[model samples]
Target: MKTFTLLQEVVHIPTKKKGQVITTKVDREGKQMVEVKYENGTTGWSIPEALTNFIQDSVDHTGEFLSD
Candidate 1:
């Protein structure tokens, strides 16, 4: 399974809120979705691609948090 752990905080576009990407998975539509735990303590899922404006290309390190 593919996944990612964002090293820095990012804004979830749909909510226009800043949060950490605590988890990720490929959803039913085959989109790489992120489950963000926002600063408000609420969580939401969305494709990180939409937040590209601030999330530079290098920060997207797939499976970087996985363990053996």
Candidate 2:
């Protein structure tokens, strides 16, 4: 299992709201997933592909933050 430590995905949400939190991870099966984790511990999820594209575009724009 792998986990990303930052709320980088929150920026990708088009709504642009603050105070929201998310937790994204890769399960043992390697499927990419995102969870909207709240301060209260409840959560929701989305396709990591959206984040993949967001990161890709950012890298293309600034040539930074590449991952392996």
Candidate 3:
């Protein structure tokens, strides 16, 4: 079976009031997929390529964190 490793990062979402949690996923090819879930159980997906930058940044941060 062909297997692909999944990478994930948690990002802060600006909410109407405060404290919103958003999840983002990045594939090996730099494709970004996002999911946002509301307290009411509503959810949505976004395909903004802007997430690639965030994914890279997070990966760098993780490496730094692990090295320390």
Candidate 4:
């Protein structure tokens, strides 16, 4: 499990919001999926690649930026 903040708003997953990725998994079809916990207490599944700019960084999760 890990946390992540979006670089921009994604409106299609129930609402246009920002959230932290709580879990990552590979489905039976071999596709990568991520479970995100929105700021509003909602959870949804999406592909990591689907996120516009979801990049991983070695910096602290508490930091404001996830990438350069």
Q: Which candidate is the best by lDDT?
A: 1
For model 4, the superposed segments whose C-alpha errors exceed 4 Å read: 1-15, 53-68
Q: lDDT by residue for model 1 over 1-68, one digit each (tens)?
A: 43457645677666578777777778778888888777899987767764433356436667558678
| Model 2: lDDT of residue 65 | 84
Alpha carbon lDDT at 48, candidate 4? 60
Q: What is the lDDT of every predicted structure here?
A: 0.68, 0.49, 0.42, 0.58
TM-score of each: 0.58, 0.34, 0.30, 0.53
Error of 2 at 62 (Å): 15
lDDT-based ranking, best first?
Answer: 1, 4, 2, 3
Query: Which prediction has the highest TM-score against the true structure?
Result: 1
Give me the runs in candidate 3 sitting further than 4 Å from their true place.
1-21, 49-68
Candidate 4 TM-score, C-alpha based: 0.53
Candidate numbers, best TM-score first, in rank order = 1, 4, 2, 3
| Backbone Cα, N, C clashes tallied per candidate | 0, 0, 0, 0
